[model samples]
Target: MEKIAITTDYITLGQFIKFIDVIPSGGMVKYILQEYTIYVNDVEESRRGKKLYPGDKILIKSIGEYRITKQ
Candidate 1:
């Protein structure tokens, strides 16, 4: 699993955009939500603003996968 460290207790949707560097601007989060291109804790999450906490596994299709773990 690719470990992604959380620098804080919360991260907004806009911040998530940076983490995913591949998706084109303006349609990144939308694409993920609409296409079910992401998974949280092994389940697909369609909410663009889905708050991710520590110990969550996020799967981004085509780009890669991330396992969020607290420091």
Candidate 2:
């Protein structure tokens, strides 16, 4: 598991994915989101614009776990 600090109240899933280096670019994030399953707070999430807040846990298939924190 890894911890990520967010400077804002929330971050979009696509932004978070890129922030964590899960995907190389914005164009690829949509494709990756559609191809794989990403869990937000233990629920399957497919929306690229899904909002993630502090303490949210994201499970990206084959990528690893990421926990969010407020900075």
Candidate 3:
């Protein structure tokens, strides 16, 4: 598991994906999100606009887990 400290009220899934370097481009992000599953606090999530706040845990299938925290 890894921790990603964010200084904000919330971050969108797409932004978070980019912030974490999941995929190289925005187009890739869309494709990856469709192909893979990302879990938020143990529940599957697919919306790119899904809001993620501090303390939220995200698990990207076949990749890794990330815990969001306040910076």
User: What is the lDDT of every predicted structure here?
Assistant: 0.69, 0.93, 0.92
The stretch of ten residues in a row with the least summed lDDT in candidate 1 is: 11-20
On lDDT, the candidate that comes out on top is 2
Give the candidates in order of TM-score, highest first. 2, 3, 1
Per-model TM-score, in order, reads 0.72, 0.95, 0.93
* Backbone clash tally (model 3): 0
Supply candidate 2's per-residue lDDT for 60.
Answer: 92
Ranking by lDDT: 2, 3, 1
Q: Candidate 3's residue-wise lDDT over 1-71, tens digit each?
A: 89999989999999999999888886777887899989999999999999999999999999899999999
Model 1, residue 56: C-alpha shift (Å)? 0.3
Summed backbone clashes in each candidate are: 0, 0, 0
The residue pairs in collision within model 3 are none
TM match of model 1 to true structure: 0.72
lDDT of 1 by residue, 1-71 (tens): 68877789865544565675655674566765666477778887777677888877788777678877677
Cα RMSD, each candidate: 2.4, 0.7, 0.8
Question: What pairs collide in candidate 1?
Answer: none
